[model samples]
Target: MDNEDKKQDIKDDENKEQNIEKEIDNNKISDEDKKNTEKDNIDSSKNTSSKSSLETKERDWFFEPKKDGSPSTVPSDVENVIKNHSTYFLGDTSEKVIYLTFDEGYENGYTGKILDVLKANNIKAAFFVVTPYIKTNKDLIKRMVDEGHLVCNHSVHHPSMAQVALKSKEKFKEEFTGVEEIFKEVTGKEMPKFFRPPMGKYSELSLAYTKELGYKTIFWSFAYNDWNVDKQPDPESAKKRIVDKAHNGAIYLLHAVSKTNTEILDSVIKELKAKGFRFASLEELK
Candidate 1:
């Protein structure tokens, strides 16, 4: 009777050990499955973030009422739409900084004089140009680089900027990369990662598109109808308009195509300086 009881007791101990081993193996498998599920979730989040970056909504950009001695404003709808993306309609309000920008869609023989005026005043500005402008005006683009001025991206073509919202990720990236390639090819220098929408037209999606490409989407606080090469405005009156509308954090957009701008730029600079407003580069906005 004692021997049989001893054998039964041994059998029970072995069964208990086997059950404990099975539980440990099951826990190991469960832990591995949990880690793999967590990894999949993280990868999924990353993919979603990248996809959302390309799928952006659109908003039309419009400058608010700008008057003499008054700071320009941005529309709230536009502002609300683009606030998350890297864009600026105005700079630091506490500083009396004037941002002078020029659009160069094509050469009109006025850029050189404008450069001269800017050089004479010792103020650095941002000049935005399309690909054709860069290809044709390599010397001026080089001059801008050598003189510490920023040559910004205006796009590969002077197309309507509203279409950027409809672009696929590849097409959206192409707009910026296309210009950067040509700019680097033509001037042998890296282009400044700043952009202005063509024809002063843009959508919130376009702003986000540019921001995703490592660019700062710049909009003017003040701009006039200065792009006309033929029917240019009166130089005296134009100068007066530019200066009188000056305010803190002013981003003034002029066109290099305008003969009046080339002629009146010096006076504009002098008058703006006289009014206690200092010209600054776009970088200061950051």
Candidate 2:
């Protein structure tokens, strides 16, 4: 009777050990499955992020010109990028307003007259200056600041910022900080946190970096081929083109080097003012 009881008890203990081993194996399998699932999810997320990064390629700012005095039409994707990066090309369309911006790559002997016209009109505009321009034209830059105009960064070497940004974020930042350092040295004031990509060339990455650097990227709604100094457009025709293209929330990109722009700026301002379009500073942009 004692031997049989001992054998039965031994059998029961072995069964219990087998059951415990099974449970342990099941738990190991469960843990492995969970880890595998998590790895898959992480890999999937990384793939999606990589695809999104690939999609954010370089893009040039463009708009459809309309002579009906309506707001110009920009591509929906372009508009989305601008908004996503907190950038601006157009202002509040509900109000008739014009934001005048001049790109000064270099002094072409027209900036002073342009300044005189601006002073006479009591209109404050934004001047996007390059590092070279700021270095060479300190007085003009100072005048811009003194006159309540916004002196903004155009870049260090005025290359396509998208290219710079894609290469390295530090380099992209240097493009802005370079101008900022010089301008601060010249004007003794902090440069405005506004930027216009050189030649209106930019990309989503560039815009993102710009926003990270605490700058608002500015594009233009209306621009003509007035940058070529060798062949400036006729002032009368240029003025007609400018006034005809005047729409609500228009951001006009004029070359400060353009003699035609300097010649016709006063008339264009008066005409636009008469049409109930108030000139506004970028700071007033909604």
Estimate every model's Cα lDDT from 0 to 1: 0.82, 0.90
lDDT of 2: 0.90
Per-residue lDDT tens digits for candidate 2, residues 79-177, read 766777868888888989999999999998899899999999999999999999999998998988999999999999999988897788899999999
Question: How many residue pairs collide in each prediction?
Answer: 1, 0
What is the per-residue lDDT of model 1 for residues 1-286, given as tens digits with 9 covering 90 to 100? 6999999999999989999999999999999999999999999989987656543444445677565577887767666766887888788768778989988888988888888888999999999988888888888889999999999999887765668657575776777788899988987878888998887677666776678788998888888878866788888888878887888988888888898888888888888888788988898877
Highest-lDDT candidate = 2
Tell how far residue 3 is off in model 2, in angstroms.
Answer: 8.5
Clashing pairs in 2: none
Q: How close is candidate 2 to the true structure, as a TM-score?
A: 0.88
CA RMSD of each candidate after superposition: 3.6, 2.8
- Considering summed lDDT, which 10 consecutive residues are worst modelled in model 1? 51-60
